[model samples]
Structure formats: structure tokens, C-alpha cells
Target chain A: MDLLYQIFVDPFVQMGTAPDLLVQTLWEGLVSGVLYALIALGFVLIFKASGVFNFAQGIMVVFAALTLVGLYEKGVPAFLALALTIVVMLGLAVLVERLMLRPLVNQPDIVLFMATFGLTYVLIGLGEIIFGGDPKVMIADQLYLPRGAIDVNMLGGFVSLQKIDIAAAIIASLMVAGLAVVFQKTRIGRALRAVADSHKAALSVGISLEQIWVVVWFAAGIVALATGIMWGARSNVSFALEIVSLKALPVLILGGLTSIPGAIVGGIIIGVGEKLGEFYWGPLLGSGIESWLAYVIALIFLLFRPQGLFGERIIERI
Target chain B: MRMKQLALGVALAGIMAAPALAQNSIFVPLLTYRTGPFSNSGIPIANGMHDYLAMLNERDGGIGGVKLAIEECETGYKNEKGVECYEALKSKKPVVVNPYSTGITLALIPKASVDHIPILSMAYGLSASAQGQDFPWIFNPPATYWDGLSMIIKYIADKEGGLANLKGKTIGYIYFDGGYGLEPIPLLDQLAKDYGFTVKKYPVPPADMQNQSGLWLNVRRDRPAWMIMWGWGAMNPTAVQEAAKINYPMDHMIGVWWSGSEDDARPAGAGGKGYLSLNFNSVGANYPAIQDIQKYVIDKGNSQTAKDKVGDNFYNRGVMNSVIIAEAIRNAQQLTGKKEVNAEDLRRGFETLKITPERWKELGLEGFAGPVNVTCTDHNGHHAAYVQQWDGTKWVKVSDWITPMKDKVQPLLDAAAQDYVTKNQPWPKRTEACDKSS
Candidate 1:
């Protein structure tokens, strides 16, 4: 009864008493959710177009960030380096599509996934060799991202929100909206959907599968670059950032694997839920519950809706 | 018949020539991680470790006239990989093995005596390994984790006026949830009990290191008067960033030695200003030994180290590690009168190791590090460490060298060591005789 009281009643009481901390925790969760959504969006783009779960998406974020920072460190201007990084990502999309996807086209989906695992290692090795292993400071100042925090006095206390986190949330939202516009309205979007539905059928209808793959991958690369900048600004850009990408798996499970809006909603839910769980209930469990809480939430979601909150439903006539 | 004879003869010749080739240089295998998550910290240290030995070979023709064959096997900071590297390299007859990771050092401790090679963990590994009577082949000179923890407490006590003033105060500990981070907890808990303070624990799992917003949010809620971090690699900078975000007092927050690096602090930028961490080795390229390393190693295009990172914290740490190894080799050479001393000879050197202030100057390392002494029953000398504060750019030493409370620490260390031996029943007894040279 005491344990139950501590679990169910005490947390709510604490929440009521310390509303400022609750807001801070929620804000942190929202920021984390935005980042998770950005990474999941990259996964969504590739899976939607190619039907391949791109394992390389995580390393791609690190690689893209490293390229931008590496170029800037080599004396290239920040904006120019950002442009070159985008170009590099485009070139990478072409290279990956040509070398990895084209040959493995019409092959088993697992084969494509395994090929992405290989790409992850290749990017990790290449990033280490080119940038050297030291963690590079992201050029947040040069990129005109805000520094410091905005302390708002409310709830009888102050809630400090980092300016960079605020900027990141705005930027992530804008990119997601832009991706939504492209997917819903553009001709390329129709081609990608056609390929995602049925590759052979799309080919029969005169859609170039190769072209769609590159375009979708390039789109995913753009998402990854945006994610790398925001996450890198939050921490330092290093190979370690790839591990945090695993957080997106739960997000993908919560938000449908192929749905854009689902990604955003899923990210926010998992993020906020985990933060709240960790903050309120973590002490009872001796802390460190934040690591596994997202997966637990995802597991509950899986039990109810394996297709996720917004995923397409399938029905068999047989 | 001719083909068979020639193949057999070549094989015989190769077998005969192998030992001869090994005899010309001293083999030292560095279990390093230049890739993976910890590479940012590992790379600089790897370079420093490699560069110093490479410098010795280039400048002094190696310790005692034998060129040191320094080789690095990448562990990527994984325990299994570290053990694998150890197994693969142990056959090379390496005079000493420096398993940089605490987990790896723990894995290698039992193998050390059996293999007849000294394991120099260098201020890390099992804190109980300081009891050299039990862990004769394992040397973690300078200080142990328990020592460092006590010193941190002592430093805190000094700042707060007295030990009595710490009563009713709460101290938060955020640590990497591993053997390395967990090593100091028993001592810390004891210290908390003795000092009348509450200990709030935050264990950062390896996976959750980068995402520590939840951890810091808890900190903000708990409102601990002081925060102590035992973080490493990416966790260090992220913790610093999160702490700064929650408006935690930067000066009140302190990290262990591994958590304090340019890589750790620079990412946090101006927000990490006034953050404190402990250090045994002095920072900067001002030391003559460091200049020699730059002159013979980095300047020669031989070292993989960047031009700017010659005197960075982790790099200097690696250099100091090699300095101890080199000193051990020299001492072994003098005692055994062998140019290329074997592993057993090196073990003797480690057991009888002593470096005074005069010796520090002689080695071109004046004021670069505190003096280290490893005795027959005490491997780690439990030296004093000073506090260094990050000024947003570089570390500035802000305090005198503060020694650990050895009277309080030694009892705990002995009990822990005894507990380890009792648990591992078939633990080998120390049969190696003490050297008369000591």
C-alpha cells in the first residue's frame, strides 16, 4: 500500500507542488521529442520510398554534421560549408543509390537492410579518418543559432529554456512542414509513393525507380543534416551521437514507420512520457529509468497497435 | 624432395629468426580505442601514449639502449574486445600492458600473475588493486579511485569550512553506470555516513549518456548543494551542458579527472566556465619532457596527434602513462643489468618504483606531475591531486595539492581487497620475492 501510494499519489502531489520543474521537464521532453522526430522523419522518408529500413540514417547524421564542421574548420565559411555539406549529402545519395541500392534492387528487403549496416560502418570509418577522432565543436555561433537561455518567471518559480533548443524546435518543425509539402504536392512525391506501393507496378507505369530512390534518399539526407546540426549543437558532434539515434526506433514504433505526422506525434509522446516517467517515478526505481522507459512505452503501444498510431491498415481477402 | 627441403629450411630459419628480432626491441602493447563512442577521449590519449614512446625511440634510442616496439590494439572501449586484444598480444612477451579501461583492467588482473607481465592501469582499474600484496602484478600508481573520492570529499570539506558543516547537506553524484563509476560508491557511502550528509545517486547508463536532460531535471528538483560527476567520454560534456541548462552552479559542480578535458568542456562553451575537476598531472607544453615529445614526435610527422593537442589533458595523461612505463623499464634495466629486460624484471621495477622531485627534473618532467612511489605492499602511492577550473578556454589550477584521507581510505581498500580474494577462492598467492634493490 505504501509503495503504491508512493508510485501513484506522491508523484501527482509533487507535480502539483513543483509545477515549474514539471514545465522544465516537459520543455526538455518536447525538445528531445523534436530531435527524435527529425531522425524518425529521415527513417520515414527512406522506408516510405524504398521499403528499406535505413540503418545508415544515424551515422549519416554524424557524417553530415562532421562534414559541415570539418569544412568550416578547414577555413570554409559556415554558410558555404553548410551548402557544401548539402551537396555532399546529395552526392552521397547518388553514390549510395548507384552502388548499394541499384544492384540490390528487387532483392529481398533484408539484403537492403544489411547493406545499410555496411554503409553505417563505412561512414563511421570515413568520418573518423577525415575529421579525426576528436569531437568537434559545432559552429552554433557561426550558424547564428542562439546561445544562453530565456528564464520565464511563472508558477512561483523560474523556467529556463535554452535559446538553441527553442531554435531547434522551430527549425525541426519548418523542415517537417517542408517535407510534408514536397511529399503531398510534388511530382517527385507521387513517384516515391508509387515506388513505395509496388516497385514492379511503378516501373510498369513508367516511374523510374532509380530516380525516385535517389530523390527520397536525398530528402532523407536533408533531414539527417538538420538533425545533425540541432543534436550536435546540443552536445558535441562525435560518433557517440549515433547511439542516440536508437531512440528513434521507439519513436518509429510509436509513430508509424512510413507516416510523417505519425513521426512528429510519436516523437513528442515518447519524449514527454519518458521525461515525466524519469522525473516522477525514477527515484523510486533508483534512477536511470529514462533509458528503458521509451521502449516500455513503445512496447505498450505495440501491444495495442503494431501498425502504430497513424500507420496504414492492411486487410487480406483470402 | 628439393621443394620440401627448401620449405622446411625456410620455416626453420623463420622460427630461428623470430626471437632474434624480438630481442632487439622492448615490446609494449597499448590496448587502445581510436574508434567508437569514446574515441574522442581515446584518440588523444592513444596519440600521447604512442608519441612518448616513439619520442623515446627517436630521441634516446629507447629506454636502456633498446628501441621500444610500441603497438596499439584497438579495443573500442569494449571489455570483450579488450580481453581479445590482451589474449592476442600476451604471446608477444610484452614487458607491460596498459589496459586503459577499468573494466579491461579488471578482466586482465587475474591473467597478469599467470602471464608474468605487469599490468599498469595508471590511477584506474580496481581501487583495491592498491593493496599490492594481493595484486602484485597489477600497478595503478599515483592514486586509486578511493583516494580520489576521499580527496574530493576533503576538498569539499575544506571549502565548506569544516567536516561538521557538511551535516544535513545533500551531495548529488552523477556517474557512468559501470565498474569504473561504481568503484568509488562504497567509499563515498562510508564518507557520507561519517560526515552526516545525504547521498543522491544518478547512474547514467552507457546508452543514456548523451540524453541527460532527465537526469539534470531531477537534479534541479532535488536541489543538491553540491554535485560530483564520475562521467567520461561524451557523458562529460553533455552533463556539463545539461547542468548549465538547469542553472546549476558551475563552480559547485566537480568531475573526476577523466571527465575534465578540453573535449569535455569546449563543447559546453562559455556555459561550462568555472566548472571544476581534479588532476594529478600538470597541464601545458611548458614541461621540458613535453617539448621533447613535440620536438621528436609531433614535429617529425610521426605522431597522429594534431599540432594543437600536444598538451591537452588526456594527451598529457597518456604521456604521463608512458613516462611511468619508461621509468619502470629504466629501473628494471639498471637492476637486472639487461638492455631489454623481460616481463618479470619489469614487474620488479614496478614494485620498487620511486620518483622524487630531483628525478622528475632529471627526466625533463619538472613540475609536470606529482612524485609517484610504488612499494612492495602498496602499488598506488595515493598521491595528492589539485583542483583545476575551466575558464571557458583552458584549465587553470586553482588550489594546492590536496592529499586524500589515507587513514580512512586504507581500511576500506584493505577490506575490499580481502573481500575480492575471498570471493575468488582460487586466487593466486604472491610468491614473488621482494627485491633487495629497494
Candidate 2:
């Protein structure tokens, strides 16, 4: 009886008594969800265009962020550093297309996936050699990112929201809206969707697979830069940020690997679910449940819809 | 036939390299992690250790006329790679091995007795390994996690007016949930019971170290009067940032020594001011020994240490570690009456090692660390540690060396050591005995 009441009655009662804290928790959940969504968006862009799981997306986030900061530290102007970082990302996309994806174009999906694994190590080694393995402060101040928190009185208490978190949510929404426009209205968007449907048919229709690959990879690189900046603003920019990229996998599973909107919705679900689970139900299970709760939520969702919520249905003619 | 010829050639090369290894030097292999997720802290510590040994080789011609041959085998702070490095370097006949991470230290504890090599974890391994009877081959000198925890509790008690004032007050503990981070739980639990205080535990998994809004939100909900952290690497800075976000008083929050580096607080800028962390070694390059290290190692461009990180907390802590090891070598040489010493001789050296004030002055590290004295029964020297406050730019010492509650901590250590021995049956028994001097 005591266990039952503690499970069902206590958390709700606590929420009622301290609505301000509840608001704070929900806001935090939303902010983290948006960041996770951004990372998932990177994975979705590449997967949608090329059917290859880019394992290096996480390291690319770190590498892009590190390059921006490292260049700024070397006396380059902040905006120039930003522009140079974009050029570097473009070069990276071209290099990946020419060296890795081009040779393995006709191979099995697993081969391309394994190739990204090699890319992950190469980037790690190169990043360390160049950046010297030290955590650097993100150029948030130079980039005009906000700081401090805003406290508002509500529900007979105060709720604090970080200014940077608010900015992140806003910037992420804008980026997502921009990507949606590019995918739906642009000529490259048609070719991308056509290739995503069937590579042979798209090629027969005069869409160059190589050109589409480079564009999608460059788009993913931009998403990675946005993610690195937002997340690094919250924490220090270091190799440890790579691990947080794994959080996007569950988001990918929940949102559908090929659906951009699915990535956002899936990210919010995992992020909010993880926070609420850890805050209310985590004590019952000895805490640290946040580490695996997102995966479990994604797994349950997969059980109901094997193709994911926004993913296209698979209809085989065999 | 060609493959066999190649194999024969490799065997001949291996045989020829054996005699060259036994020439005139003492080999000490350092299993370090200078590149990885933990490299933010690992690089400085590795640089300190490397620079100190190099200083010895350059200035004094090594300990007692034997050149110190220091080799580094990078483990990248992974347990599997640590074990691999151990196996790879064990054939080199190193006098002692310093497994930097607690996971690697635990892995090597059982192997050390069989291999007849001593393991020196310095301030960060299993708290129960301090019991010399059960863990005869492993040494965590200067202090243990239990010691560090007791000191923090004592300091908090003193600040709160009295130990009785802690009753009914909730103290929160946020830890990394790994072997090293979870080490102080039993001691903290025992202390809470004795003091009548309530303890709330918040664990941060390694995967979620950078994403700890959930933990801090819980912190806000619980509203504990004081919070202590057992975090490392990237977790340190993130936790500090979250605490600042929730407007937690930086003075009321404290971190363990591993979480006290400049890297931990520099990211937060001024918001991290007044944050407290317990430290065993002094920070700064004002010491004569550090000056020698700069002149001999860095100036010559023979060191991998960054010029700016010469006197950082973790770097200085690394130098302190080498000081203990080098002094032990000197002690062993004096006792054995030989220029070169073996692993068993190093063990005896550790048992009888003493870092008195006079010795510190002689070694040119007069005020760098607390005096350490190791006995046969106590692998941990039970030395006191000081609390330092982050003053925005650097850490400044704010308190004297505060000793742990030995009376309260010893029984727990003994019981834990016994429990470990009972669990790992057929554990080796200690055959050597010495006088108690603490």
C-alpha cells in the first residue's frame, strides 16, 4: 500500500504543491529536446540522401566546434572563423564523397557504415593532434550568445530559465524551418527525395548521385556546426561531446531515420521522457535511469510501429 | 619458408635486446592517458610525472647514480587498453606501475601479487585497498577517498557550528557512478547514521555527464543545504555550470580533488568563484623543484607539457606523485646498498618511506605537499588535505591541512577489507610485519 501510494500519489502531489519547479523541469526538458533534435537532424539529412548511417556525425560535431574555437584563438576574427569553418566542412564533405563514398557507392550498406567508423577514428586522431586534447571555451561571447538566467514569479514561486537555452531553442527552430524549405521547394530537394526513393531510378531521371551526396553531407555539416555551438555553450567543448551524440540514436529511432519532422518529435519525446523518468521514477530504480530510458522508450515505440512514426511504409513486390 | 625465416629473424632480435635491458638503469613504466575523453585532466598529470622523472635523470643522474629509464605506455583511460599496456610492459621489469584510473587499478590489484610488482595508485583507487593486510601489493599513499570524505564532512561540520548542527539537514552527493566515483558511499552512509543527517545520492552516468539538467533539476526539487560531488573529466565543469544555473551558493558546494583542476572551473568563468575542492598537493610554480623542472625540461623543449600548464593543480599533483616514487627509490637504494633495485626492494622502500619536513626541504619541495609516512600496516599514509577555493582565475588555499576522522574511518576500512578478502577467496596473506607509527 505504501509503495503504491508513493508511486501513484506522491509525485503528482509534489507537482501540485510546487508547480514552479514543474515548469522549470519541463522547460529544461524542452531545451535539451531541441538540442537532441538538432543532432538527430544531422543524421537524418545524410541517411535520407544516401541510405548510409554516418557514424562520424558525432565526431564531426566536435571537430567543427573545435575548428571554430581553435581558429578564433589563433587571432582570426569571429565571423571570419565562422566562415572558414564552413569552408572546412565543405572540404570535409567533398573529401568524404570522393575518398570514401564514391568508391563504396555500389557496395552493401554495411560497408559504407563501416567506412564511417574508420572516418570517426581518423577525425579523432586529427582533432587531438591539432587541438591538443584540452577543453576550450566556446567562442559564445564573440559569437554574441546570451548568458545568465531570467527568473519569473509564477504559481507562487520563481522559475529560472537560462538565456542561452532560450537562444538555442530559437536558433534550432529557425534552422529546422530553413531545412524544411530547402527540402520541399528547391531543385536539389527533388533530386534528394528522388534518390532517397530509388538510386537507380533517380540516376535514370538525370539526378547526379555524386552531386546529391556532396550537398547532403554539406547540409549535415552545417547542422553539426549548429549543434556543436549550442551544446558547447552549455558545456565546455571537448571530445566528451562525442558521447552525447549517441543520444541521437534513440531520437533517430523514435522519429524515423528518414523523416526530419520525426527527428524533432522523437527528440522531444526522448528528452522529456528521460527527464521526467529520472526526476520522478528514477529514485525508485536507484537513479541513473536517464542513461537507458530513452532507448527503452524508442524500443517500445518501435514495437508498435516497426517503420517508425514518420518513416515511409515498406511495400515489397516479391 | 620465407615466413619461417622472418619469424627466426624476429626471435634473434628479441634475444639480442634482452642483455641491453639489464645495463645500468632502473625501468619505471608509466601507464598514462594523454588522449581521450579524460585527456583534459590526463595530459597535465602525465606531463608532471614525465617532467619530474626527467628532472631526476638530468639533475641528479637519477637516484643514487642509476639512470631512471621512464617509458610511457598510453592507455587512453580505457580498462581493456590498461590491461594490454600492463601485459606489454610487464616484460620490461618495471619497479612499480601507476595505473591512473581506478578501473585499471582494480584490474591490476590481483595481478600485482603474482607478478611481484608494486602498484602505486597515489590518491585515487579503491578505498579498501588502503588496508595493507589484504592488499599488500597495492599502495594509495598520502590519502584515500574515505579519508578525503571524512575531511570534507569534518570541514562542513565545523562550518555549520558543530557536528550536532548537521542533524536534520539534508546533504546531497552527486557522483559519476563509476568505480572511482562510487568509492565513498559506505563511509558517507556510516557518517550520516552517526551524525543523524539525511543523505541524498544523485548519480550521473558517464554517457550523461555533459547532459545533467535532470540531476540539477532534482537538486532544485530536493533543495539540500549542502552538496558534494565526486566527479571527473567533463562532468566537473557541467555540474558546476548547472549548479550555478540553479543559483546554488558556490561556497556550499564542494568537489573531490580529482574535480578541482583549473579545467573544471575555468569554463564557468566568474560564476565558479568560491567553489571549494579538497586538494592534497599545493598549486603554483614558486617551488624550487618546479623551477628546476621548467629550466631543465620545458626550456630545453624536451617535455610534452604545455608551457602554460606548468603549475596547474593536476600537474602539481602529478609532480607530488613522482616525488613520493623518487624518494621511495632513494630509500630502497640506501637499504639495499646497491645502485639498482628490484621490485621487492621497492616494496620495502614503500613500507619504510617517510617524507618528513626535513626531507621536503632537502628535496627542494619544501611546502609543496603534506608530509607522508607509510607503514607496513597502513598503505595509505593517512595524511591530511587542505581545502582550496576557486577565485575565478585560479585556486587559492583557504584552510590548513585538515586531518580525517581516523577513529570513525578505521573500523569501516577494516570491515570493508575483510569483506573483500572473504569475497575474493584464496586471497594472499601478508607474511611481513612492522611497527605501528601513526
Candidate 3:
């Protein structure tokens, strides 16, 4: 009976986060949610295009950011290094088209995903060779990111929000909107969507699958680069960046792989939900529940919804 | 047939070469976490180890002109991989093992006792390793979690003017949910029982601590007078930010040595100003050893850290770990007469080490931790620590070196170590190795 009290009843009784503290806690969750969503955006972009989960997306972020920083450190100007990183990502896209995608065309999705696992290792080794293994503080000051926070009055309380976080949220929303416009309105976007819908049908329609693969991958690479720079500014850029990227798995589950809107909404929900959960309920369990909270939430969502909030309902032909 | 003949021939040649090759240099097995979540900190440490060996070779022509050989196997913080690395390297007759992870060190404790290989778990590993009589082969120089926790509690007590003032005051503890974070719990509990403070604990889960509302909300709700944190890696930054969010005064927060780093501070730069953490070694753009590191390690392009990131707290600790290993080997050479000594020789070296203030100054570590004097009964050679506050941009020393309640801590170390032995059913044989005197 005492054990039961310790396990369940005692936890809630101890809850006493003040109103101001509650608002601030929610703000942290919202900020972290944005970052998690940014990482998941890259995975969703690739998964939607190729039907192959890009395991190397996380490393790509680290690798791209590291390359940019390393080149800048080598006396190359920041803007120039950023340009060169784009080129590197493009070169990588071309290399993937020629070496991986083209060669393994028509392969099973599992095979393609496994090949990405191989790619992750290759990038890790290559990145380490090109840029030595070490964590680097992002050039936030150089990148001109706003530092410090603004205290806002709310619910007879106050909440502090970093200016850079606001900028990130704005930029991420724009980028997603831009991608949606490109996919819906632009010729290349339609071709890519066609390829996503039916690779055989897209080929029959005379769309050069090779061109679409290169273009979509290069676009994903750009997303990865942006995600890297933003997250790297939060902490030092290092191989550890890869671990942070793994948080996207729960985000992807919450947001369906096939639905872009799902990724956006799901990422925010997981991010905000985990924070709120940690703030409100973490004390009951002795804290540290935020890590697994997203997966637990996603699992529960799966049980009820089956399809994600915005995802298409499956109609099995069988 | 040809493959078999060639393999047999190669095996025979290797066996023949083994006896012909003289073992003049000591082999130190490095169990490094150079590719894990901790690698942000570990890579620099491994680089420090390598550069110091290079420095020895460059400056002294190698431990009395016999040279030092170091072979590192990357563990990435996996205990099983660390054990595999230890097994793979032990056959090479290593002088000692310096495993960077607490998990790995715990795994190696039994292996070290059985294999006769001494381990140097500096400022890490099991908190009870300070009880050298029980832990025959383990050396935790410059205190343990118990020592660090006492120092913080002592400082807090001193600030409050008396132990009695702690009554009804809640003390918050946010620690990682692992053995490394758990080490200070027993000591904290004892102090709370004695001091009449209500203890509130919040455990940070690993790799998933970015959103830490659960922990920080608890601190705000409890309204603790002070918070002591024992966290590492992502846990540090997240905890700091969460604390800042809940408007917890960063100045009243205390972190253990492992949790305090430039990387850890930068994320919470907004709310982290004046956050105090214990420092066994001071770090910054200053420090003479950092000059040696920049000149020898980074300049040579052999540094494991970015050239700009040198002199950061964890990077300096990496350099210090290498210094400890090198100094031990140098001390071993004095007693053993052999230029290259084995694990037993290094054990004696660690036991008899007398790194005075002058030696530290000469080694370009004038202000790092004043001095470390090793003894058989006390494996933690140095018991002194000072407080450093992250002043938004850098770590600045805020207090003189203060020794914790050693009289109170020693008995706890002894008792816990005895419990470890009894639970593990280790033999009651006395570790007479301390008396061998080479």
C-alpha cells in the first residue's frame, strides 16, 4: 500500500510548479518541438519522395554543418562556405543518383533503406576524415542569430522566449510552405510527386526518373543543411548531432511518412506534448520521462487513429 | 595448400618475432569513447593522451629514453565493447587501463582484480574506489562523487552559516538516471538525515533529455533553497535551460566536474550566467598546460579537438587525464629501473606518486588542481576542489581550493567498498601490493 502510494498517489501530490514556471516550461517544450520537427522534416521529405527512409539524414546534417564550419575555419568566408556546402550537397546528390539510385533501380524498398545504412557509415568515415572528429561551437555570432530572450506577460505570469527561436519557427514555416508550393505548382515538383505516386507510371509518362531523383535528393540535402545549422547553434556541432536526429523517429510515426502536413503537425505535437508532459507529470515519476514520452504518445495515437491525424486512410486491396 | 602454408609461416614468424623484440616501452591500454554521444568530450581526451605521449617522446626522448606505446580501442561508451577492448588489449601486457566511462569502469573492476591489471579511474568510476584496500587495482585520483557532493554540501552549509539552518529547507538534486549520477545519493541522503533538509530528486534520462520540464518543474514546485546536479552530455545543457526556464537562480545550482563544460554552458547562456559548478581543474583561454596543448597537439595537427575549442573545460580535463597517466609512468620508471614497466610497475607508481606544486608549475599546469599526493589507503590522491562560475562567456574561478568533509567521507568510502566486496563475494585476501615497494 505504501509502495502504491509512492508509485502513483505521491507523485501528483508533489506537483506544484507555479504559473510563471508552467508557462516557461511550456515555452521550452515548444522550442525543442520546433527543433525536433526541423529534423523530422528532412526524413519526411526523403521518405515521401523515394519510399526509402534515409538513415543517413542525421549524419548529413552533421556532415554538411561540419564541412561548412571547417571550411570557414580554414579562412574561407562564411557566405562562401555556405555556397560551397550547397555544392557539396549537390555533388553528393549527383553521386547518389549515379552510384546508388541508378544502379539499384527497381530494387525493394528494404534494400534501398539498407543501402542508406551503408551510406551512413560511409559518410561518418568520410566526414571524420575531411573534418577531424571534434565538436565545434556553431558560428551563431557570425551567422547573426539573435541572442537572449524576451519576457512576455501571460496569465498574470511571465515567459521568456529567445528571439532566435522565433526566427527559427518563422523560417521553418516558410521553408515548408515553399516546398509545398514547389511540389504543387512547379513542373519538377509534379514530376517528383508522380514518381512518388507510381514509379512505373511516371516512367511511362516520359518523366526522366533520374532527373527527379537528383532534384528531390538535392532538395532534401538542402533541408538537412538548414536543420544542421539551426540545431548546431543550440549545441556544439559534433557526431552527437546524429543522436538528436534519432528523435525524429517518433516524430515521423506521429506524423505519417506519406503526409507532409502530418510531419509538420506531428513534429510540433510531439515536441509540445513531451514538454508539457514533463512539466506537468514528470515529477510524479522522478523526472526524465520526456525521452520516451513521444514514443509512448505515438503508440497510443496509433492504437486509436491507425492513420495519423492528416495521413490518408489505407484501403487494402486484398 | 598455399594459403595454409602461408598462414602457418606467418604465425611461426610472429611467434619468433615476439621473443626477439624487446619490450622496453610500457603499453597503456586506452578504452576510449571517441565515437559515441560522449565523443564530443572523449575525442579531445584521447587526443590529449596521444599528444602527451608525443610530448614525452619529443621532450624526454621517451620515459628514460625507452619510449611509451599506447594503443587505443574505441568503445563508444558501450560496457560490452569496453570489456571486449580490455580483453583484446590485456594480452599485450599493458601497464594499466584508463577507461573514460563509468559504466566501463564498473564492468572492468572484476576483470581488473582477476587479470592483475591496475586501472586508473581518475575522478570517475565507482565512488567507493577511494577505498584502495578493497579496490586493489583501482585508483580514483582527485576524489570521487562522495567527495564532490560533500564539498558542495559543505559550501552550501557554510553560506547558510550553520548546519542547523538547513532545517525545513528543501535541497534539489537533478542527476542522470545511471550509476554515475547515483553515486552521490547515499552521501546526500546521509547529509539530509543529519542536517534536517528535505531532499527532492529528479533523474534525467540519457539521450532523451532535451525537454526537461519534468525535472525543472519539480524544482520550482518544491522551491528548493539549493539544487545540486550530477549530469553529463546532453543532460547538462538541457537541465540548465530547463532550470532557467523555471526561473531557478542559476547561481544556486551546483554541478559536478563532469557536468560542467563550455558546451554545457553555451546552450543555457541566457539563464546560465553565474551558475556555479565544482572544478578540480580550472579551464579557459588561460592555463599554461593549454598553451602546451595548443602548441604541441593542435599546432601539430594531431589534436582531436578543434583548434579554437582548446582550453574549454572538458578539453582541459582531457589533457589532465593524459598528464596523470604520463606522470604515473614517469614515477613508475623511477622505481622499476626499467624504461618500460608493466601493470604492476604502474600500480606502484600510482601508489608512490608525489606530484608537488613545483612539478605542476613545471608541467605548465600552475593553477589546475594544486597538487596530488597518492597513498595506498587513499586512492583519490587529491581531495581539494574550488568553485567556478560560468559568467555567460567563460568559466571563472570563484573560490579558493576547499577540501570537503574528508573525515566524514572516508568512512563512507570504506563502508560502501566493504559492501561491494561482500555482495560480489570477492576474496578477503589483503592487497599486499602496496607494501611491495618495488
Best-matching candidate per TM-score: 1
- Residue-level lDDT for B176 in candidate 2: 89
The Cα local distance difference test for each model comes to: 0.92, 0.90, 0.78
Sort every candidate by DockQ, greatest first. Answer: 1, 2, 3
B1-438, model 3: which lDDT tens digit per residue? Answer: 999999999999999887644465667667887775676657766766666676676556667777677678999877889999999988888888988888889999988887878888889899888777887788888778888888898888878987789888899998878878888899899989988998988887776544455466557667899999998766677677767766788888999888788777776766789788998876764766567656765677764566666667776776777788888888888887867777887888888776788898888777666688777777786478888899998888888787878877877888998889999884555455674542
Error of 1 at A98 (Å): 0.7
Residue lDDT tens for model 2, B1-438: 999999999999998886666768999889898887788878889999999999989988888988899999899888899999999999888899999999899889888877889999999888888887788778899999999999999889989998999999999999988898889999999999999999989999999989999988888888988999999888999999999989899999999899999989988877899899999898999889999999988999989988889999999988998998898899888877877998888887888889998899888888888889987878998889999999999999998889989998899989999998898888888875553332
What's the number of clashes in each of the models? Answer: 0, 0, 1
Pairwise DockQ winner, candidates 1 and 2:
1
Highest DockQ among the candidates is held by which one? 1
> Looking at candidate 2, what is the lDDT of residue B265?
90
Separate DockQ for every predicted complex: 0.84, 0.82, 0.40
Candidate 1 residue-wise lDDT, A1-318, digit = tens:
999999999999998998998898999999999999999999999998899999999999999999999999999999999999999999999999999999997799999999999999999989988987788889999999999999999998989989999999999999999888887799888788788888889999999988998898898899999999999999999888899888999999988998999999999999999999999999999998988999999889989998898998778799
lDDT minimum window of 10 residues, candidate 3 chain A: A9-18
Off by over 4 Å in 3: A1-25, A315-318, B1-22, B209-223, B237-247, B266-272, B282-312, B334-337, B358-368, B426-428, B431-433, B436-438
